[model samples]
Target: MKKLLILILLLPLLFVGRQVYSDDCDTSSVSNLNESQVKEMIGKCQKNWEMIVNAKKPHEESLRQMEKQLAAFQARLNTIASDLKQKEIKINEGDALLGKQEEILAHRVRQFYIKSFYNTPLLLIFSENKSNVEDVVRVLAYQQATTNDDKKTIIKIALYIKNLEDKKKQLETEKNQLSSLQTNVSEQAGKVKKLLTEANAYQVKLEGQISQLSARQEQLLAEKYAGSNYPMSVGETEPSRPVDDRTIDPGFRPAFDFFTFGYPHRVGMSQFGAFGRAKAGQNAETILKAYYNNVRIEKRDNLMGNINVNGYGSKSFEDEYLKGIGEVPSIWAEKGGYEALKVQAIAARSYAVSYTNNGQGSICTTQECQVYIGHNKGGDWERAVNDTRGVVIVSNDTNEVIKAWYASTAGGYTRTSADVWGRSTPFTKRLADLDGAGKAYEGPSYGDSPWFYVAWGSRSEYGNSAWLKSEEVADITNALMLYKADGGTLIHLSQPDKSNGDTWSSDRVKEELRNRGKNPYNSVSDVDTSSWRNGNGITSTVIIHGDAGDNTFDGGDYKYVFNIRAPANVHLKTALYNVEKK
Candidate 1:
């Protein structure tokens, strides 16, 4: 029993000692793993988790059984103890009765001895009468019979006391055995509990490893399908065009349509909106003033003669640099987009002057700065540049050149600098980009940009359809629920990679939702925008109806979680986007 107790006390220590020497699940190396390595590691981690769970089950059952056995042993030991106590009380009573009976028998034997030694010998010695002698013999016989009966009664009482003592001793022996058995069972239970604890800790460790592997996988996939992969610049010289989702047929019914209001950053001028305005007989100055609030078109002569251009050394700011900027299509000039070209020219020139701080800094030659091709883009583009010679957009409040940030499209509304970058600028304003009567000109007669409103995805890669399936949409909703619950650890909840065997199954996501105390949906039945940013055209609140129920979420959060958890090629281009269920 002592040895068993000592072993129980040492069980946890032994387990700990073994764990200290054993190989642990080291997730620190996850960052160094490539996609293939990460997938392999995830598989191994999952297998390890299964092994730990399997190992823990038997120990848990054994612990339960041991607990029940210990309870039974305790009850039996109590019963034995009670029996022994009652037998002891009876044995004590029997001992007192036997003592009294023995004393009484001794006194009676002494009185009979005195009477027989005196009276009976005198009757025999006198010999006067036979009857007298006969009477003395009868009295002696009766006394002997009475003494025998007393002696027999005392013997029976003593025998009964002995039987009670014997029974009490047997019960005590049984109680000792049960107590030892109970201690053994308790010790076994302790050992099993320790084993179970160790198993649980190992399971947690494996789970952590799996999470790290998944996060690394997600990072790799995100890098593969970065937003930079999309074309942010627009011009005839730009190589790629945005994929129009309308041209493709979504093979599945009840599609979840992700309608984006704009293509890129909606911070400044909308290039297509300018085209539409120019088509509607608006001049370059009018279009620029409409987008840039409180800004004037002014020709500045104090500008530097030469500005440093990245990868091409210094160049003339007006004569050489302005001619090569290819922001809008030259073909638009033939199609009544001349005023828009002039607007682009002036905006590009003003942006360069402010960006360089009057030639103090160098600028890159990408859309990140401005798309600049080396030679003069002789054509309508050159004509527009020359027509707006030395002209720059200057802020009225600051009396300085404005940055004049612009993008390809703005859906229907433009965002302010404060809305986009969290820093307010005097020149930038959130405008509806509509006509005088609150009518937009972006559909057929004007800008006609393909990206005005469309679903986003890699159509060439994923079945020529930019629309999402019902289950896929539900998965995105689940991702949002998890993000709302615990956004920190759910970084890897991206769409599963089937090729690499690192898929986060739909059932798995549902299980996680249940574990986090959030409802999971099987399919998204409908989705609609609940609120919009007043005058900004950005969706604010969205309500998603699923099989589980309807849930409301912040628009920005929905966009963020959707981008991260959606398929690699599919993503919302901006936060100011909407979702439609078809």
Candidate 2:
């Protein structure tokens, strides 16, 4: 019997040993992960860092070139302006010279006309006739000859004057053309100078950003050592926002609160669960590649809400929508209608909330909160987030989500502002040699110093909430007003409900809703709404310890207790159980 006892004791010790050994990690899968993996990962991260820093390299060089070109262009412009001024003066002098030439031409033409009219006529009259004729006939012939000679001289002089005027007009046209060319060149030079000035300013801004990134990278590296090992878990609780059984009128559609429970952005599939656990220094790209050929573009609809919608006439719930029921009219409970929000509340209570603190935080616009400013690819995610401007309703009975009333974060209204950090301490991203603890002093490997430290900076691992835009408040308030317009109970999850940490509840939440203009309401019991109790007050849900079934109460372990299987992509860390056994 003593030997039997020793064996029994040894069995427990063996089990414990196995558990401890499991903690050492499974290195067999990564046989080649000596120091090589670490170097490769760090190298990739460093490269990405460099790309961001060097985004301005070309611009900086362009700015320098611009400065050089600008100065040269300016000098050329100045010289052109001076030469243009001198040319303009010379043009004026040429005009004066041309005017003098025109005057001389006019005087010569006048003299020729005058000489032709007087001397030529007289010469012709005298030479021609007195000897040639009968008195009347001879006189007439001489007169005609004289007249012809005079007309010929006048015609010649007029032609000469016309040629001189044509020459003068051509000279004026050439001068105007030269002035226009000078003006165009001057305009182009001015444009280049303006562009150069803007480019220099842009380069300076980019340099500042590079400095900030360098400092921030160092801070990130420092936080690597302080990382947490455990994943976050959700606690058990009765649904705070319970569905009403009597409240099930026809044509009810339970509006699922989207912002809080909508599927979270997926992290890349991990060969190891978390990024830190993967090969150190390896970036997400390399690690992801090594595990799978490449990151597959998985359809997001593959991960739908985790709930059994049998009342809606479907055996299983698919992606956030109801099939077959769409054909049914609003009057039918089986089709276009939902079980009063109360009946649906029970199934949801069995469902778990997300691992993060569901949208409760100090929302802000500063880099502290990493507000999604509608500019990048990630901007699309902003549409679905609640920016802390509205209210959310939960069932008092089970604490499952009932509704999330969101405000528009469109305008300039703000609810709050704060930063989320990766570490408690601040550091720079220096490329220096790291100590045993990976602490940095300084070097090429080291980046510039950071401005601030955020405790929960990485949403990839730690998870994140949204920043409420000031503009969203009225829309959020109006939506909440609609829920309050009818009758709805508001349950707050952040406030502690019971003495133990097992649950969280708040009367203040209901009051807040009422203040927001919701109708007056009363609290109901979870036992009446949930499968918490049978006829004898003997519980059917989980019981962990001794008699009254109160030790650690959880729902049953029956896989399909609610006549449903767990949904795909559902994350259940804490097991639920039935309290049937002692």
Candidate 3:
């Protein structure tokens, strides 16, 4: 019985030990693992990552509460300090008054003694003047009465001084105790913050491990299924055409088309929007000012120095580094987009200077930073670079060079750094890329970006079909329902066609949906989309009418499920999207 009790007590500890061991994702052995083993590892890592993420919130809240408490304690300590200073002043004033009173009492005593020595009662009685004797007696009685009052005043003042000293001592003791408490609370807050930071670092480590494992899994799958057409994920600048519903025969009378607003992260200056604005007769300054709010174009001639470019070491900042930038098409400069090219040059220059911290650091030659193609791009690009000489975008508030983040397209709206990356910057603003009439100029007549309002899919893998069938659409809704009902492995909800392994079959998904008290649909009859603009624009709500019933989903949730469950060939690239029913 004792053994049984001991085992019961140890059960929780054993379980915790196993959990900790599982959470330690050692990717060093991933290379030797099979496809199934890698996928299983990914699942475990993802689960652990979620657990860490959820656990971070409480610690963060506790830290915030402790900080508030610390502030309150500081304010209270200040008040007590101020009170002590005032009490000390009063005590000094009382001491000075008591000294003055003591001097007056001593002088009065000397006067009384002198009068008694000179006008003795024996001489008054021997003299023949009775009135003189009575006057002397009255004067002596008055002097004695005044002396008694002075003694009472001295005693009262002494008692008051003693009380003040006692109160001051009490305040000092209280102050010391409070200071100690504040220190302990501050230490606790520091500990909480450290734990939160460690958790964040652990989360990053887990994510890295998962990324490595996923890469291995992808490699293993690619090796296993050689010669099979596996669709590639969409790139930022992949040339794509808009889905024309009139041409696509989806093998059904009624079909739906999903149109995405933007291609990539919709933050900072829109390159295509800049081109469009420049074409609209706006100068380079105006184009830049429109994208980045409250900024000034400043010329910093002193920034002329050498910048270390990876692979191509130590290039001239003004001439060599700026010329090698191949961000925009050089041909655009010749075709009435010279202002846009100049904007790109200035933006690129500013980004380089800020990123390198005035030539103290090194920048890479990839889109991860700014694309730096070695050697001068020459032609109009060279002219654009020279035109913007030493000009860079500076934040008016900070008076420092802005990062000048620019993307290929922002669809129509741009988001702040805080909205996208959880870090706020002073210069970036969320603004609509609209014209005088408050309409986006990134459509057919303006920016003319192919990624604008296009269905996402790699054409090579889908047999040139980017459109979804009715049943496939229904499967997406089913996946979303199951996800909302029971939070499980996200990849399990992925479409069977694109899933490498460990995905729920269509039948199993529908069964799970039904088990969770959700109505699973066979085919989507009709779909409706609603959108409202915010930091992350459009596609706010979606309502789907299926054979089983109608279901409504939040747009962001729908986008998440769509990206996960949709085929690799076709996925929603951004959250801002619309659905059309025909």
Candidate 4:
């Protein structure tokens, strides 16, 4: 937060950095001025304060969100910790039961051994029966008492002990799970608690700054306005409606798709790259340039509109929208700390701004827009948001805000906006990524090259052990058939005519393929795997022969190829994939 506390960028003037307001305003109150000047000054102060307050709205909401999440996590942690204790107790009890059963079994075995060994005929004869009557009688009695029932009792005790041991092992495993869950929940709560304290302190600092300026605001406004005559327009930019404004969807960029979809920055695992650089002592801006192409970090003007916050129509800042977003994994912010999260905050801010082009809908709460579930106020995320407040990534080409689309995975190359969205965006075209050799499977983080080949199935998430089987060929065939489906059916959905250059997975493929009556692929040999970007690995294109015949389907440029879907359990991993025999 020291980054935010430092007013280096915010010092020279009021309202915005590097921007002269429609009218220049004094940074301090009580700077002597004329009557007209005073009025303008007061107006400026009030307006700037309003904007600042508006900006603070999101941060406040973010804090609220964080509090809620922390509370929930705390509750969860408590439950898990309690369960862990219970499981431990159960295991201990089971141990005690097994030990007692073991003792009883040992005692029974000793009794049976004594009864049979000492009473043997040879031993009895050598001892002279009457002389050793006491020992003989003891042995004879034990031997007589050893019945079929005694043997069954020993067997039963052993089995009972075995069952107790198994139960104990099961309880131990459960205890471990509870312990892990507790750790996760506790970490979130602890971090959130620390952050909340920092956030409150920062807020207090801001309040003090605003209060000092407000105290002398009236006198300064009066003096400035009395001296000059400057016309002021109260309503230059009309307040816009959300529905009318351009809608922006700031959501999770899927694993491969984040990098593959057009955004100038490092698409997937861009955070990892940022973290690596940040830890290496590179500043935030240096890290930003590495992933995003043609990046310009600009101090954004205050333009946040009212948000349908938490279902109530509340006026909040744009940063709130970013902080509220749950689509982003907390791990990046937690592991990488400020630097890594700073990059995320910028990307998210830019992505949100691009969507806020219009005064559109109640804040989009789903990944359909960008998942905004909200967060606890004081955390690394809040720090990241505050550090780079109002800053956005702009494309140098058009000098416009770039539509920052990102995902979790990208084949070796980022997708061309034209191919994916059918738009001719210069900046978001297919670009090369640094995919290593073993890129087919998922890794610990997003920066790694994931399998783009639909056939190279590794549902690393599910268990990292699934592959495309021959039976799934039908699904792959169907995805390809969707492209071949009479051409006009789903093409309109893509709007080839409209090109703003945004590319993510086209759900239109799935939607179009739906309700189409198709038969399952009966054979793998009958399917074609010849057309490939990389034969044994990930590729941008792959041809799946819907039919064993020579007839070809019309593919845009790659020519008739099977379009594999990414959903692993249901669809193939990518377009380029081969089916393994079941």
- For every candidate in turn, the CA RMSD to the true structure comes to 25.8, 30.3, 9.4, 31.3
* Candidate 1 segments whose C-alpha is farther than 4 A from its true place: 1-230, 237-244, 459-462, 498-504, 530-535
- Judging by TM-score, tell me the better candidate of 3 and 4: 3
Candidates ranked, most accurate by lDDT first: 1, 3, 4, 2
Whole-model Cα lDDT per candidate?
0.77, 0.27, 0.75, 0.45
1-582 per-residue lDDT for model 1 (tens digits):
355345344443222234332354567888887654575567567666766665666667667766776777777777887888888889888888988998989998998999888776766878888887888888888989999999999989988988888888878877786687677667767777877777778777777777788779768766756552445657655335456665656666787768777768887888888889999999999999999989889888898888899999999988888888878888888888899999999999999999999899998888879988887888999899899988999999999999999988887888887676444799998888777776665544577876677667664454555678888889888877875787553534656643234445667878888999888999988888846546557888888887899888888878866766676567777766766655
What would the TM-score be for candidate 4 when compared with the true structure?
A: 0.38
lDDT of 1 at 449: 74
For TM-score, the strongest prediction is 3
The TM-score between candidate 3 and the true structure equals 0.66
lDDT by residue (tens digit), candidate 3, 179-287: 8767876777777777677777877888789889978966765553343321121222234555554466655556676777765777788887888888888999999
lDDT of prediction 4: 0.45
User: What TM-score does candidate 1 reach?
Assistant: 0.60
Better of 1 and 3 by lDDT: 1
lDDT (tens digit, per residue) of candidate 4 on 73-121: 4565566567656656665766676567667656766776776675676
TM-score of each: 0.60, 0.21, 0.66, 0.38
